[model samples]
Target chain A: MNKEVLKALERDARTTPEQIATQTGISMEEVEKTIEKAERDRVIVKYKTIVNWERLGEEQVQALIEVKIQPQRNVGFDAIAERIYRFPEVRSVYLVSGTYDLAVFVVGKTMQEAAAFVWQKLATLESVQGTVTHFLLKRYKEDGEILEGGGEKGRRQPLTL
Target chain B: MSPRPGLNSKRARSLISKRVEGISPSGIRKFFDILSTMEGAISLGVGEPDFVTPWHVSEAGIYSIEKGYTMYTSNKGLLELRQELTRYLYTRYGVEYDPETELLVTVGVSEGLDLAMRSIINPKDEVLSPDPTYVSYGPCTVLAEGVFIPIPTTVENDFKVKAADIEKRITPRTKAILLGYPNNPTGAVMERNELAEVAEVARRHDLLVVSDEIYDRLVYGVKHTCFASLPEMKERTVLLGGFSKAYAMTGWRVGYAAARHEIIEAMTKVHQYTMLCAPIVAQMAATEALRAGDAVVKEMVADYDRRRRVMLKGLNDIGLACFEPKGAFYCFPSVKVTGLSSEEFAEQLLVEEKVAVVPGSAFGECGEGYVRCCYATALSDIEEALRRMGRFVERHS
Candidate 1:
């Protein structure tokens, strides 16, 4: 798995191949090969920047929709999950155990748009027994990055005893 | 108004010791005074880590206080802490010290340096050390009434204090050789064989060796050779190590010294009268650190390695000549290309670029053409600082 190279990149995606070599105590060529393999094998799905959207004043409506569905003879929950995840508004989908068969993450520009996805596309599906929607109000942390340590981060006093 | 209170109080200027008065003020002080008023400035001046003490270590300290273990520990420190240090030294350095007699916990490696010099140095005795070494060594030597003989090392030799350079400067009264590795300003580390040569010299000269290994855990792509572990050196070497750089526990003010029973005893005697002991809470935390925080230190070291590579490459790419530094968090890049003194480079960079670096000459005269930039800062800030420095160097050049 070349876990060291993966860890170096996972901690900081912007880390260069040369830096990955230094951090992992490996050669630059090895780091490049491992990362290339990871990308090709889908172990590393994508490299994307985590922007502070709130700073740009572009607020998003994100909701987690817990869905229960009847299991089909041939494909249990997998068919309904694919059906729910294929929609443009649905950001992520996971088949969870316990109270719900699948937990869907949906995002939209407005609450109405987010709610309508549950009502129109998700709830109306066949064998879609029930659904509950919880809207995300605020994100204090995301993707292992603290969102609040940024705002009002007063720089330390320049010189002191 | 008659003489203003602090501004015009001048009666006691001569009362200061002539020894202290002879010492020059830190060259970086002026730059720091200038930096204080500037807003949004990035500082590469600090010598310590940007990371806080690991939460697990702090949790252990809190847990100790919760159990009412906050009394003044033994003058030497808690027995358990000393035992942990014994195990650590044995396991890491392949050297052993008796927990009961040979190890003494002190306030910090700073205090260890002070106590070691004070205990062994007689009045007017000369101590051989590196020219551009840690800033504390010279002052501590003076405070102990010892004559400090600076053996200069240049960038050509990777800033290491060579045995021949040190041996040539030794005199009849030369009592000891003091050095810090994974050194502070230059980030230079002496290899095992290189230091073994120095150890041979010490054996020939019959001098003590005081090794401050505060940055022992911060070396990148290099192994630190503990002086006391080398052949026939342990009996004459006083090893100083601490949790400050390793576990990011600087504010805790805890460190230890291990040596032959005599040297440890003498330093402990000085410690008893002057500093008493390291704080019990900190001692407790250190004990926990030695036991459980190896993984945390490794993680921090890896993070620093990534930042070090970036800073080195970025600075070198921008035309600042930095010989590869294999240890510590600093990168001492030559700023002589700008036709400016080290102090002037640091000052102008602060004023124009709003990035603060310490002039390397603050360490010694041989450091004149260099500036010490600490990479303990954030990676994004390092990149940004490099960009500003690139423009500054371009403008000046």
Candidate 2:
């Protein structure tokens, strides 16, 4: 099982355990067990997707949702935000000091959807008192990559069959 | 104090070199750098049109030089050109400005942006803009010592910034708003009604509006609206426009800004100190562009619209979810099926498939799970790129 997991990582960190088993001649059960252990031991920190939002006409609208929450008796603000993050729309949540208690990142299908998510969902939470959303006007870089650095490098090549 | 030679060795200015430290060399540039060095890479990441400068436009510049009109003109540019600009704006978008007082020719829209920020931004003042927008705004604001306040517009509603959303982000420090129509990355355009809504908010807040309309002529079905053209916005709005995108004169570096006399005066002071004026020959070429360039612009827009349709249809056919872009030549598609982050997907496509694309995250944080594909390439190239992308998706799936 350990050898199978090793082979899978070597092939592609993005490959799933189910795929690993099929490719490495290992049972799915053993692959899953090995993957669980690897994750528990901090080998795989995360899994992510790279989307071409431009192609989907999906403009990436990011706003810092500053939340001022009413701290619960025993649970505190952290507990309240944890509950808020359960929504798939919430991308990231942080405990911040100063004027706001929490900074949340939310995604929506449109400008209106993002606004609705904040006004109707996140803002309506019982513990929430006030919310301020700052929408990103443009993105120069995200996760350490540039968007419009020019020439052929800036071009998006078509996929081959 | 002078006795210890090692104790005071200039401290090397705290560690990171200033050149490499604050200047986060454009992420797009770095990606291209990597691509240039790699083998078998085909890229559709560039933002501008692939067409060369129209022949008539180039001829105008050459004519100016042949006629010995190479000397510097007035700081506000040739009167004939400014008047032509005034007429062009009025006819094209219903925008009005006193060309003599309100307009200042600059090197490009890039310089206009830099000049606007340099003129209006007091240290720590806030400049509001939309997210996943053109890449230069935030960095320019920072370089001008102004705080950049980004308002994110998402994929769902075609990436338009709502007036209510804009209102919520305003604060005492908010001094201005930067508006880009026929926007970059998302290809979102604001109709007249939408511009009016934004104009009302700016008026109430007493905010200065910097309107970037470089892609004005590229709108497919929608009419492009200028914020300054609205009733009250002209007084508070600085109009940034250029010939690069429309005339395919990018390398010529010619653009102009129109604003209230006072604002123009301030921008000119900065412009005079930094750039003097746009190139003389280029200005002559632009003058001709303002006059006879309309037909050329129309022809290019028609071609782009056709290509845009082809690419959009191809993307949807390939099972990738894409929004219909109203302006500009880009398509932002969601790459969720592969379960790879924008960067991972881009890297793999480049390395394994030889297809080059920019990760959406390179645009901003919300740009994760996406990539921007420019349709400026030829139809055949776009078709090939889509096919390669479909195969890449299948391989990962």
Candidate 3:
């Protein structure tokens, strides 16, 4: 694993290859080859942006759904987890160990749409026994970024010893 | 003797004491004053990190306040904080200090440096330090009633002071040798073998060595050698370290000094009477920092290393000859190619291109031909500043 290159890209996916080469003291060609190999090997799955939708006056609703399911023959939670993750509305799915068997994150344009997904799709799965849903109210942080009050930053004096 | 004409203003100023009056104001102050009023100026003048204190460290301080733990700690500081510091020192450098007797916490390395000088210097004593040194060292020595001696270092030597240069400047009244590496202004890191030679000079002369390691953790691709950790040197060295640079906790005002028991006792006596103790909330935060600050510091260091490389290359690419700084966040590039003094270069750049840099003369006499550019800023701002500086350099040269 070219951890240094990966770390730079993970911090800011838009960082250019030349910048990575300068930062990690690797040659430009090596950096390009390593990134290409990593992408081919699936070490880097995808590059995406974490947008603050509220700033644009867009309404978005997100919810977490805890699902309970009966284990099927030959394929336990993997089969059910895969089915839950394949939905476009489901942002993420994880096999959790607590009282819940699977934890699923679902996003929609409105609260009604998100709640409808829990009732219409998740609760009606064949092996699903029960489910609980919690709607997210506000996002104080996402993807390691604080979502508020950074406008007041850069108050440090222009010059200091 | 009779209250002479109620004192003219000039006489009144003189009454403030010849020592304080003789000390000139910092060279950095004048440029920064001009910078403050300019609109939309991009500054590479500040010497501090751009990151805020990590959220967890700040949360710990808030938690302490909620618990009503807002009382003054012991004169030496909270025992638990001291213990944590000793463990860190030992683990990192193999140097052990007694938490009870050998460590004293202060407001910052600023205060620790002051206390160290006050506790050891006597009238007419001489304190030898490298030229192009931190601005505070010379003033602090003078304030402690000691004579400040400068050993001039050059870019040819990568700004590392030679032991022979130091030995030649020593006099019978010389009391201590002061060192700050990963130096300010120059960003030079002293190699271990070179420092051992300097330590030998101190040992032979039976002089104290006061080492400031505030930027120890900021070195790029090089290991920092703790002067006190050198063989047989711990007993004669007073080590000053702080959280300001490493953990981005400048406002917390927490730092420490470690030495033999007697030295700590002496510094503690001065600290108790003048400042009382570092704030209790800051102490609590510092303790939390020692416990959980490693990963945060590692991330910040790596980020700084990247910026350092970019700034180094940018300065050289623009026709300014810059020595590669292996430590700290500054790039001291010689601006002599422009046929302008360091101050003139800084002033003209701010006026013409709106990019502010500190004149290297602010550090000391030997720093006249260079200007210090700090890279601890946003990457975009650094790039923009470099573009502006390139334009300015092109016109003048």
Q: Any runs in candidate 3 off by more than 4 Å, and if so which?
A: A150-154, B1-11
For each candidate in turn, the TM-score is 0.85, 0.68, 0.96
Which residue runs of candidate 1 sit more than 4 Å off their true CA positions?
A: A1-9, A14-37, A49-140, A149-161, B1-8
lDDT of 2 by residue, B1-397 (tens): 5775564446754565653367565566556667777776667787777887877888999999999988977877788888988998888768787887988888889999999999999989999888777778888888888888888788886778878888999999999999888878778888888878889999999999999999988998778887787897789999999998999888788999999999999999998877887889999889888888577888788768766876777777776778888898888888888889988988888778777777777666767787888888776677788889888888887
lDDT of 3 by residue, B37-88 (tens): 9898999999899998887888989999999999999999999999999999
**Candidate number that wins on DockQ, 1 or 2:** 1
Instruction: Give the per-residue lDDT of model 2 (tens digit) for A1-161.
Output: 38647645643567666545543446779888888887787776665555547656776766779999999998888789888889888889999889989999887767788888999998889999999998877666565455544222333222210
Going through the candidates in order, their DockQ values are 0.26, 0.02, 0.66
Error of 2 at A148 (Å): 35
Pick by lDDT: 1 or 2, better one: 1
Error of 3 at A57 (Å): 1.3
* Candidate lDDT values, in order: 0.89, 0.81, 0.92
Interface RMSD for candidates 1 onward, in order: 3.8, 14.6, 1.3
Best by TM-score: 3
Supply the DockQ value of model 2. Answer: 0.02
TM-score of model number 2: 0.68
